[model samples]
Target: MTAHTATTLRSAGSTGISLPEAIRRADLGDAVALLASAKKYTVARLSGGRLSVPGKGSFADGAGVAGTSTERALPLSTSGPDAVFEARIFNKDAELRWLHEGDGLGTAVVLSESPDICRPLGEFLDPLYAVEQIDNRYLLWGRPLRSHDSGASTGPLSTGPLSTGPLWVRLAEARIGLLDVPVSRAPRENECVFLRTVEYVTTEPEHGNAYVAEERLVELFLAPPEQSKAAGSPQPDRLPEATR
Candidate 1:
């Protein structure tokens, strides 16, 4: 029912809970499930450079991230199709600011405070957005970076690609960073949560998994089409581009 559900394997209280305790209990599976299922969450789009955790006063970028597990936390994530939703959650990254009881680190942002996305956004994204629910990963159809007119995106996120193709995110990675900002349903995309970055991320159509956009990341429409039948539904493994 809540984002914390991913952080903790056990069901989180529908209302009022301790952020640290929830995170402490959350495992990778719980986090992935939360990201795949939560209606919204705040996801951090890597500003630039490789993903790294910042200490209270400085940024740390070492390959071995295991040491920061107990103290690392990032305070941002973009949600909603096309990444229109953004929210601030407890500052659990690097600073461990949440450890301070009265700092208001884990305080949840009010849904009303989020911006409104035009119905067109939902309509535009609905055909391409969806949640995998079980795979613990976000998938999207891929388009080249040049396909768009704007070339200002110089960040590493312009398009999602591995050594050969587009990029993919672990469900837990996306969910933990995202805070679903609220918007009333206009187009169906408004009804779901997505993984986004600061810049656009690209994935190939045949890739099955979707890409994450930067500024407003895209959650690939992996779910079955609202208009389609489920009898022969395409699973992620057989992704015929999951949704329309």
Candidate 2:
């Protein structure tokens, strides 16, 4: 996408919001950021469910089940042929096991050093916002794209099998490194990754509705959960941030 086109999409409908900007502000230095409290990552998706305060338009729950989550990360790098690392972060509900229902959601985007990498995802950031279904991850945008990869317009990214495993990219660690550690397998929407720490976060909705705009109440403690025996402070300094 050209600079002109990039600017075009941001101005499309919703103010100047674009995926890159959202990722920029995600606080984690990734596409997503959770407000920190105590020793836990406050993982919140833009809730499809909204908390309607009488006259309020409908504010979606920004935070999900807090201390009950585990994070697996891999940094984004490698510029030459593969700048775009594509994959799906899939999870199902604790009780409801339906795919494409969007029970799973999250993205912590660490900005890459390459403009090439950011540009591709930029093309569809607007559509991502306009999408009616709040939880749907981008299978491909409805738009035809002329990608930098082939100079040919391709459809949305091939829907890789809902990652039964965790997330992406590569290079020798000489100057490259994986984000955190690639997750071995995806935790079911509400399963615990560690047997000892049963406080894994659930992507499942606090309430059931086919789409977002309904508010789901995720429980979060001012402190870590009683079940967590693991120890560490989720201090802001401990989390990664964009190079900028």
**True-vs-predicted CA distance for residue 56, candidate 2, Å:** 20
Alpha-carbon lDDT of model 1: 0.22
Cα displacement (angstroms), candidate 2, residue 53, comes to 19
Candidate 1 regions exceeding 4 Å error are 1-15, 29-73, 76-244
Local distance difference test, each candidate:
0.22, 0.21
Model 1, position 131, has a per-residue lDDT of: 26
TM-score each candidate.
Answer: 0.22, 0.17
Model 2 lDDT, full chain set: 0.21
Q: Candidate 1 has what TM-score?
A: 0.22
Looking at model 2, report the run of 10 residues with the lowest lDDT sum.
Answer: 1-10
On residues 1-75, what C-alpha lDDT tens digit does candidate 1 reach at each position? Answer: 011111101111111323333233221111111121124323222222112232332212211111222223444
